[model samples]
Target: MNTTKLAGNFLLPISLLIFSLTAFSCSADLEDKVVGNWQGYDFLFQKTEGPDIVVTINGGLEQHLRSKLILSDNGTFQKLVGEYDNGKGTWVVEEDKLITTNENGEKLIYTLLKVTDKELMTLHEVDLKTPDGTLKGKIILSYTR
Candidate 1:
């Protein structure tokens, strides 16, 4: 092969390898940013037979419930506190969504609304089925780190 042709072939593969490595590194860094101690305000509303009840959810519930969430770099852990509820259990992040399971192993789906250096917001809804059909309660949680 001519000098120019050989150089072009070598450069092409090297450039592609470098690009792939950089992309993977960046993705790993972003995943780390999601892991840490985050504090924020949470409001939970539930629809009951009598009326709608609004409760302010914090780190500890009613001075009786205490929880902690430790999100690791691998997206797996034991008993991470739920942001909306006092339930404690494991959590996992798949794609753009975060799935939290309480001690009972019930899955809670939360979609990432907004995530910044100081704030993280998520929206979730509980599936409720009644004689009339299906009803769901919506919840929004805002947190600051």
Candidate 2:
């Protein structure tokens, strides 16, 4: 093939390769921003039953003393270690949401609202049902990194 034809044939592939590389790099940078140690606190509400009656209740707040978030390069796997007033537990991030299951099989879900070099914010919601009825609450958590 002539020089001009050969160059034209290779130009498209080269341009596509460069574009793909740029996109991958940008995504990787974003993922890096999400990976690190993050600490926060959560206020929770729960329903309780007394000898007399079942009641909707506000569970006292708990502080998250420390948390470490690790994200894999491909963003497929994430692990979280969170320390709270009661104890510490392992968590996982799925679909950009953080969830942890306690020994009692209670599942807690948290959505990451914002993360910065010095701060992190999350929203938590829990719903439960008992013989009496269903109860739910929304709580906001904030932390300093």
Candidate 3:
């Protein structure tokens, strides 16, 4: 067995192990691109319940509360509406989805549409139970950094 050939064979596995460890630390939880401060841009509410008619419902309960949305690298988030505040929650990116769990234990799953260094837009499907009945719809929140 040639000594140089044996040494070279051991080097390949060692080099791959080092590369894999570095890659793992760099992408821990996959939240790198979304950890930043975002400003509220615009929002749209759509009701997707009816058979033929699609109506835009208005009012508030996750309304267009506009201001600052801060997504920390530590996996926590805060949304400020005006000065009083809107809500605070923990957020994580699961594949292409942004999952947020509010303080009230309400979990809202949002489909990550477009996330960039400048803008972040998400679509959230929600079911609200009121005195009348259940309202099924989706909300799109657009934000810019």
* 1 versus 3: better TM-score goes to: 3
Encode model 2's per-residue lDDT on 119-143: one tens digit a residue. 5555666465646555554444555
Better of 1 and 2 by TM-score: 1
Off by over 4 Å in 1: 1-30, 42-50, 54-69, 74-85, 127-135
lDDT of 1 by residue, 1-145 (tens): 2332343345435434533443333424435555765554543333222222222222223322233445555555443344445555666655445687777778887755555566555556656554554545444455666
**What clash pairs does model 2 have?**
none
- List the candidates' TM-scores in order: 0.50, 0.42, 0.66
**Candidate lDDT values, in order:** 0.49, 0.45, 0.65
- Sort by TM-score, best first: what order? 3, 1, 2
Clash number by candidate, in order: 1, 0, 0
State, as a TM-score between 0 and 1, how close model 2 is to the true structure: 0.42
**lDDT winner between candidates 2 and 3:** 3
Candidate 2 stretches with Cα past 4 Å from truth are: 1-85, 128-135
- Which of 1 and 2 is the better model by lDDT? 1
Give a tens-digit lDDT track for model 3, residues 15-110: 345334433422234468778998877665555453212232434323454578889988899878767677898988876668889899888787
Candidate of highest TM-score? 3
- Decoy 1 TM-score against native: 0.50
| C-alpha lDDT (0 to 100) for residue 103 of candidate 3 | 96
